[model samples]
Target: MKSDIRVCASWREHHDRPVYTLTATCPACGGDAVNSAPAPYDPTDRYGEYRRALKRRARQ
Candidate 1:
């Protein structure tokens, strides 16, 4: 079995200050690391679909 992993935003604080964090995941493998760097070929991500859906709802 395979599970989809994705990089979602996280948050941390510097001495209680606001901050943002970046993380990665693999959708095909459970808890596996994902590479986000430019690939030799085209890079595809599911985030685009989410963005499009949001846009559609916003326009409604």
Candidate 2:
């Protein structure tokens, strides 16, 4: 089966320390979901091109 994809709003703290947060809006009902990661989070999907794509989309 195919999994659903959710678009999210995300941010990172880049001052003294760097932390990442991602929050998604439900496409069906407009509800919100969130996730957070400490420094050195997964560099694959968490910090990789996919995350960059999300951030880029959010800016537009």
Candidate 3:
């Protein structure tokens, strides 16, 4: 059977360093999970195609 996807973000404190997290999961199966986010796509650097797509979205 198909399962719905879940996404989560988490972080740890008690330190001076900065940290970030992203996660994806399938709730139908407790252990089924994945990381579905891109590796930090900077909107400012993507000056051609994706940027136009983003700008079009902003106008809407």
Candidate 4:
């Protein structure tokens, strides 16, 4: 299951530090919250092209 943790999207404007919460809105500022985790894949992955090619081949 996805984690319940989230961070305020406008944390910089609302607080001196990031505001983490389990809800969809920041407790302090009532602003929208976003998942705090890093993306599952790296954008600079060297083998990403090869992986995409493999998936494309499998699709056909």
Candidate 5:
């Protein structure tokens, strides 16, 4: 399931550490917020290239 938790995009101006929140906007600075969760896929996945190629072929 997707996470509802997010972090302020402009956290540097508001606090020394990352600020976590459940809302789309930050409560402190009213700035934009982004998902705090790590990416689900591995960066070095060996099969990723093949998967992408298959997707492109299907599209064409």
Candidate 6:
């Protein structure tokens, strides 16, 4: 059976620091099938990328 993998965000607090982990799972199964060793992307910079895109557009 082929299972479609879906990316999910897991948020929590560790040692007073916010931890964001990107996890992958298959609906056909149950919980996450893969837990990334390090986050694929930074949660804090979520809007930063968008802001940078806007700045680039303005400069064009």
Can you write out model 2's per-residue Cα lDDT over 3-57, one digit (the tens) per residue?
Answer: 2433322222213332222335534334453433324545565458877899999
| TM-scores for the candidates | 0.28, 0.26, 0.23, 0.64, 0.62, 0.27
lDDT of 1 at 54: 96
- Candidate 6 C-alpha lDDT tens digits along 1-60: 323433333222112333323435434333344443444555688698888899999999
Per lDDT, what order, best first?
A: 4, 5, 6, 3, 2, 1
lDDT tens digits, residues 1-60, model 5?
A: 578999999898887889899999998889999999887887899999999999999999
Candidate order, TM-score descending? 4, 5, 1, 6, 2, 3
Highest-lDDT candidate: 4
What is the per-residue lDDT of model 4 for residues 1-60, given as tens digits with 9 covering 90 to 100? 466799999998879999999999999999999999887777999999999999999999
lDDT of 6 at 24: 54
Candidate 1 worst ten-residue window by lDDT = 6-15
Give the best candidate by TM-score: 4
**All candidates: CA RMSD (Å):** 11.7, 14.4, 11.9, 9.6, 9.7, 11.2
lDDT (10s digit) by residue, model 1, range 6-43: 23222121123322223343332323343334444324
CA lDDT of each candidate? 0.41, 0.43, 0.43, 0.93, 0.91, 0.46
Candidate 6, residue 27: Cα displacement in angstroms equals 64
Worst 10 residues of 6 by lDDT: 6-15
Candidate 3 lDDT tens digits, 1-60: 223333332212222332322335333333334453445655668466877899999999
Off by over 4 Å in 2: 1-38, 41-47
Clashes of each: 4, 0, 0, 0, 0, 0
Off by over 4 Å in 1: 1-43
